[model samples]
Target: MPHSLLAVPPSRGGVVPALLAEGREVTGSHLRELAARLAPPMDAVAAYHFGWIDQHGDPSAGDAGKAVRPALALLSARAAGAAAEVAAPGAVAVELVHNFSLLHDDLMDGDTTRRHRPTAWTVHGPSQAILTGDALLTLAVDVLTRVPEPEIARRATARLSSATRGLIDGQAQDLSFEARVSVGVEECLAMEGRKTGDLLGCSAAIGAVLAGADEPTADRLHTFGHDLGLAFQAVDDLLGIWGAEERTGKPRWSDLRRRKKSLPVAAALERDCPAARRLADLYAEPEPPEGETEDRLAHLAELVEEAGGRSWTEDKARALYRSALGALDGVDMPFGVREEFTAFAAFVIGRDN
Candidate 1:
């Protein structure tokens, strides 16, 4: 059991386009029209949060994130032998919930930027951002109710609720990990499962349920999604340190500046090295020198690689990716669909940032 967290993903080009197209079809202008009818007095607020306009009802340069959760919903449905049309609403609802989480997370993490723009809290302040996130969550529930089938909505509500709880638990555990310098790799994996994997599990389960998949089939999809989510996060951790700014949308080594307890740092800490001592000292330093930030970050990267953290994390991600593919292999789905997912997984693993 390696204690490091860096992950190098596989080739992922075809995966993103498929997922994005599915999401676009599910939650396009037509859904927006439907949402408008259901939104009532706060319709404008919901619209703004969706990146359609500003507080004053003027058009704004808002962002639409990668609809990963929604894509899972649609893909799971496909794996269960349903057309994308039948699962569209469920996909929309999951995406709305994911965006809601992002809104609140940015605030909690004190991130000033999101989706290549200023974060909601950074521009609107904490109270409004909190309100916006809450509103989005409420809308997510509302969107689920409009899904045409009572049973599907009921199951979706349960799944989404459970996923939300898992995400909250994961974040709590992640924050807690920071307070303690040393932690086991097992605990870190469990934390990743909760923080990042649960929502993915829910995405697959909900899609399978809507497609009328058998219980066993749905369970396998759940497993696949969970493993894939873990792999995705591991790769993301790698990007936080050594990735290019253009691709990642952040300065290089921003994680070091934040002292985030990423897999690389944890791995370095687990090993006995002078660089580990230097890292400990750096962690203790109240304020990292503004002038030396880049140089120090480079040194930290060297330490991470030297401690075998980078290679270890990459290997773990590869193992998890392989496990996810194995889970998919056990299922009887269209070869083309499965190929698409495989490509997507590869893209996730091989992303530049």
Candidate 2:
């Protein structure tokens, strides 16, 4: 069984769960109502994705990723000194939007596995998968519209729309980078900032704004979210290269196999090594032999280290964590919230899965 929320320390000064609990109280009924309105096929697909049903819509067991976005929404509200429970619908809306993106991204990437199970696209066809993703996006908006105030709903929708557009832009850049021979660390960071960072930043900012935070306060929270997100992506990059397949549930050397232009690869370009040169040579090769693939993978990792990718990533994560914590430095945090937030940050970077 997955670890219970009660098992782990909170991520943001023991505020994550208090906020999450509030959102959950509102969300359970709201989500069930929304789920009831979805058409059968679409409902089946979404239910499966949410771990509420099997591929055939029968009851089954599955799991979802940490609802990080929702936590951000709730925490942002708390940071602004509001009852985050009052903004629960907004929190659920962001979570739905995030899940919708994950569904579409899995289809676009032809990724078969997620959370140790076949992705929606893997079991269903691309058309159904695409429809499912679209439906989720629509549901997110629907959830936002029910947030009890037209103006709040409108602002939340606008922010979400912008975040979604940024995600697409980032994904486009990521796919395009695969074909380009020259990619740099700066470009990689920009791509991640847009693709991954913006959504996270917006989640926190929108929450704060909805809770009536001043512009400066909201902006600080936004910065914190962006830094945390960038650090999260760096950790993810490291896992993609060296994480255990059993833990990560991804194919070993998956990035290398795809010739992905990740941060480590960008770092390696700064060095002049035979292995680095060989990686450049092999980039365009249609298919590399196993022996050669292993050799190249090992060398590329070495080159990345030599070029200081790991050190840079570590430093960046630490700096971001500090910044995130600093944002809360003088704020009167709720009981145990600080410890939870610190533990959460460490868990994110230290995770092998």
Candidate 3:
């Protein structure tokens, strides 16, 4: 019952992260309050985007995306010894910024659906969606600044601003990769960090800053978030190529069609296999007619698997997750909270959509 897709993913096996329910409850309340404060059409647009209201302003249970990032933020605060109530603003700010990125990204990527629902840009038109995204980003900062303590507010804002800048640069790198003839695995990995990891790193550590946590604690938490984000993106890349359109709310083979040079593709290209060469050939050709695309993409997917792209990416994801959880060693926190984190990390890597 929230908007925005996952930094983690949808809960499964009934293993919801600790404080996730509280995170959703509080973040949802704040989001609704913030949406009400926006101007007339923008408020309506924002509400529609969040699945709180339909295109005609009626309520719907349509795909609202999982509220994983906000939950993670609140968990970070709880781990750092702050009450969930006290750190709610930090959680909400992280949610807003993430959604802002989604709004722009959906439009720029020309994605038509997410979570089995029409993307905001498609329903409301691209211009309105862009403006709404801009509004959400601004709102995130405003929410942070409203925190009662001036120093905490400043620290939170600065950390978030730095992350946003890195995210933008990552976006640039991502787009540039699409136009290039070749890309390296290491470079794509670095780009993935900037685009996906930086904000998540901020989300993980921001609550610590808000709670007046020391530098060492915040830094380790940042690493926790950053590595987790990379693991999340690996799953996303797999979904982009192989996910069911109905389950993922994305067009099938969208990434391969775009020849976007995702991790799998980059790694596969490095292989010395026949499929690798053919996959490269396919990537260079312009997309065929819509009717012909499915089989072509299917073959392309097979080739990627044959070249061992899929398996490598999966192994890398699990490895990144291990590194992420390893960052928590010696971090002072509740044992229960630490247990919840381990379960949550497992859940993130295990989620199918």
Candidate 4:
């Protein structure tokens, strides 16, 4: 397959560039300010995680993540006919919660690197990482509760709390899935909806709420974000299996090595094909192939593809991307703002990392 097959086409007329620039100029500054409010050591860890600093506590420019959630929040606000700045608090809150999950997820998964740098848990110790994650989660609430309008603040806080709870429950499910021998594609999709979609949905909805959008508009944006999140997760699972170490900042075939029941693997396992049965037998082993781990993993990736896992996941991602775009039909936004939002949805599934 051509490399172009890997990503959704870039949005026409440079909408992605405008959205990314706005995201950095608007949301990035506020994210930094919020990180600075943490206590010294924790602040440094947060900065490092955000890619503003290196492991030795020195300044180093690194790629923070794509900033998709904050961008979604900002764009949703604009799509509701409000200035993007009106949703800054929503952006900050969602970004904080996102980093909180990253910090703890790295620890839980024993991941040593992210964004091409050492993970916080590895550099700061798991306990410190856990505390930093906790602090970030609390700060999300603090920032939202401090919004100038009491009623808006209350609503935003409630929405964020519900999303965070769903995220935690999803994480619990993910960990449990790792230990189980079988996980259905439907169950995995539902878990992904909670683990990934709920937060993105909340981010979009919170922005609309902050902008005082009508209930129907907010619900539509929420659905858009939710579908986009699922598409993003599907693509991420594909990358976890086949992405380059340099591009993904992790070991090759990391998901296979860990036996993660990600969407692709679950889809493959659910198949009635011969390759699916063989893949299941490999997974049932108490240990990975002792001497040929690399080759075994390579074969496993082939099995997943042969079992129709790859095509199923790719088709699902495309379908969800369409569903997400369709949700924007009646959003009542400016043409330019709507284009930016569409471009962002494309970027979410097309991102390399």
Per-residue CA lDDT of candidate 1, range 297-343, in tens? 78878887787778777887889888888887678987677876776
- Alpha-carbon lDDT, every model: 0.72, 0.70, 0.83, 0.86
Clashes of each: 10, 7, 0, 0
The residue ranges of model 3 lying beyond 4 angstroms of the native Cα positions read: 1-18, 290-292
Task: Output the TM-score of candidate 4.
Answer: 0.95
Among these predicted structures, which one has the highest lDDT?
4
Cα deviation of 174, candidate 3, in Å:
0.8
Better of 3 and 4 by lDDT: 4
What is candidate 2's CA lDDT for residue 323? 72
In terms of lDDT, model 3 sits at: 0.83
Off by over 4 Å in 2: 1-29, 289-303, 327-343
What TM-score would candidate 3 get against the native? 0.93
Instruction: Write one digit per residue (lDDT tens) for candidate 4, span 58-138.
Output: 998898887778778888888888888888889889989999999999999988878887898999899889988999999
- TM-scores for every candidate against the unseen true structure: 0.87, 0.85, 0.93, 0.95
| Ranking of all candidate structures by their lDDT, best first | 4, 3, 1, 2
Highest TM-score scorer: 4
| 1 versus 3: better TM-score goes to | 3
Supply the TM-score for candidate 1: 0.87
Could you give candidate 3's per-residue lDDT for residues 135-189 as a string of tens digits? Answer: 9999999999998899989989998998888888999899898888789889999
